[model samples]
Target: MFKLDEAKLQAVLKQLHQAIYNHERWHNDLIRTIICQQPHDHHDMAKDAHRRCRFGQWYYNDVPTEVRDHQAFLAIRTEHKHMHQLATQLLATAATKAAIAPHDYDAFANALDRLRLEIQTLSREIEESLYNHDPLTGALNRIGMLTSLRALHELVKRQVQQCCIAIMDLDHFKVINDSYGHAVGDKVLSASVRYLMDHLRPYDKVFRYGGEEFLISLPSTDLKAGHTMIERIREELGKPPLAFHGSKPIPLTVSFGLAMLDPEVNVEETIRRADKALYAAKSAGRNCSRKWDAVNSTPLA
Candidate 1:
């Protein structure tokens, strides 16, 4: 029988619910505490009231939300931006050397009430999105990627069409992490994904295939076309050296192994062949693309 890890899911839900509740409660309490002690030296406290709530950072930075719910993702992100704006306003109010402004308090209170409700809405959406995405770089995770590949595989079987899978790996990725630190390595990984996403056709998809690698599927593409597409991606990615957080820019390169879908073979076999080609690319020299050799495989297999 097919079963998801229900207990694990429930634990995650409980944690998220508690996080939202605690953030809402704590922010309100802080507001009340600051407003009460407003006779002297209270302005500074009021100004920093918003900074006291760490829930948003905890949810975004600590908690992983790889769900595919775009609406939920956008809603939560919007709320996060607004929360910062409101907090900054409160801080500025405290910093000002004047009597407490009635308008400011009313505005802050109304916004806080809206945020209290927004958190619940965001939690619901985040739950839906988590099911089909990668929490780290926001790409479709392996499972999600497999689902789409399955559909494409079926299409290849039923109709006369071209398909190819390109297995791409970051060359010297561990060295990148060791030389620059893991944080830069992470940025590079995410940046590589962005480049693929930007260059790929609308129907094409690139899935995270564990670690600094991805499996990009191109529907309606022959080996020639797929090669061209991936080469373009390589050209774009290798250039414009990635600059992390205003530090000196570092160059990143990738090697690709490509295999065309064979009508007589299964998708997995084609992937295996593609992976072989990828290894060849890296072996030849990093940062080049190689195609699977079908002629050799026919005799070996």
Candidate 2:
């Protein structure tokens, strides 16, 4: 008469057991409610009497019984009560298990995992953006230059690329601040950065190394190519004097030191050598680009 197969029959039985346990717990709650309302009454005995009378009316009326038959009927009644108690406990446990099933719990776990991954990804992106950007000039900062330098060094080691590191410093930058005020001096610095960026190749990177000093990293370039680039920037900056606050334009000039990285040298030492060449350029006359000549002891004139 049942639609279910053997396995489904077992599952249905389990579900019925749970439903029976829930019914028993509900009945118990009713008894507790009555007892609590009338604290002095022995209400459990009265409840059992009521239930037995109801059961007799519903299923045991008009039956004539022998002595053995009556005894068997009493045994069946006892078994029914025991089964009700077992069903009550099973129903409670089943409800709790359903509440925490894999379907419910796994969704929550997956959401948390996604949130954590997004947070980490955003944090890494922010760090990388800040690493290469200069706060003042909006050019690459010193740390950014170093990162590019190291990459270039590796490329050269593999014989895959040639690169030059050129250092540029504004001539008499401190004098501009002293004579024209720091605001004017800042404008000059900004203009100088723009001038350098305007003339350089799109692949080139410029860094704000220090106060009034900048570094240029040129990939796929040799010493001669680097010198040509620096000369162009110097000429551009000298062409028109930068003006501030609608006043007369002030003359702006920069000194440069160009050096190609030796394949055997480390990135830091290569930058240092370029810096020494810059010092030599400044000592020479201030508005010139000088290539590092180790054999020539005399500084540029």
Candidate 3:
């Protein structure tokens, strides 16, 4: 039943092609600007400095004497021009694309019956993708988390380096979600994810374990270093009130449980220890971090 109007689709595709061509032309101009503005090796420093001072004075009255060099000013000017042109051309192309012919009314109506079926299939695929992500926070769902954990286990085994796992849960999340609608609760979850991503190192991985719970994996990190990193994230999340929808902001806090994997320990046991530490954190206080102490208790089975 699915159908795409051949004539209208072809027209739209051609317009997209033209827009792409225009973008390439603008990109070439930026390259040319960079080539033309580069300073010659023979240019004297003093002369270059004077030239820079002239341009610098034009742009800013408080230009520093040290920064007033012709070659340096030329480089800055070239970069600025290149960026400005690129942005302007991009906007123009977008505007042009927006003016492309709308779908043909007659063809679209005739195609609607087919389009409905096609859209339903696409929608189902999209829903399945969403199922693998936390609906509230847009982090990996529980199934996705387990898959990633297995991958990490394999990676650590091969590399023979220490890996740290931390479980994070928002303190008093149910109370917040209950007081506000599920919509606001969803916002809080999203905001928390953003905060964690911003604070964590680029190499670290974070996943939503389940509702109001999250997990982080830190590769090449020892217990002490991993503790320090989690502490920083906890402190930052606790300090600021998250703003939502122009209303009075609400305070947010997170508790974390940390566990480290020794090369000798099994991966499953390491994860179990981290989960235990998470429970410890919940019991000790709402906002704190607990690390697994192997000497005091039996290792995770």
Best by TM-score: 1
Badly placed stretches (over 4 Å) of model 2 are 1-131, 294-301
| Clash count, one per candidate | 6, 2, 2
Tens digit of per-residue lDDT, candidate 3, span 1-301: 0012334334433443453354345335433433354332221123333123322233344333322332332344443333343333333333344431233323323343343343344334334434555555555567666666667777777786768899899988888877776788778888888678667776677787778888888888877898998888888884667646457686678888888764557767777888888888888776888888777753221
The candidate scoring highest on lDDT is 1
* Candidate 2 residue-wise lDDT at 116: 35
Candidate 2's displacement at residue 106, Å, is: 28
Q: What TM-score would candidate 2 get against the native? A: 0.55
lDDT of 2: 0.63
lDDT of 1 by residue, 1-301 (tens): 0011334445656777777777767666556645663332232244333333566546555544443233444455555556546655665555463445787767766766676666676666445436655655556678767667767888888876778889999999998899889988888887777777767876777778879988989999988888888988887895787546467787788999998778778778888898888888888887999998687762110
TM-score of each: 0.57, 0.55, 0.54
Candidate 1 overall lDDT versus native: 0.69
Clashes of 2: 2
Give the candidates in order of lDDT, highest first.
Answer: 1, 2, 3
- Distance (Å) between predicted and true CA of 141, model 1? 0.7
Q: What is the C-alpha RMSD of each candidate to the true structure, in Å?
A: 12.1, 28.8, 17.7
Per-model C-alpha lDDT, please?
0.69, 0.63, 0.59
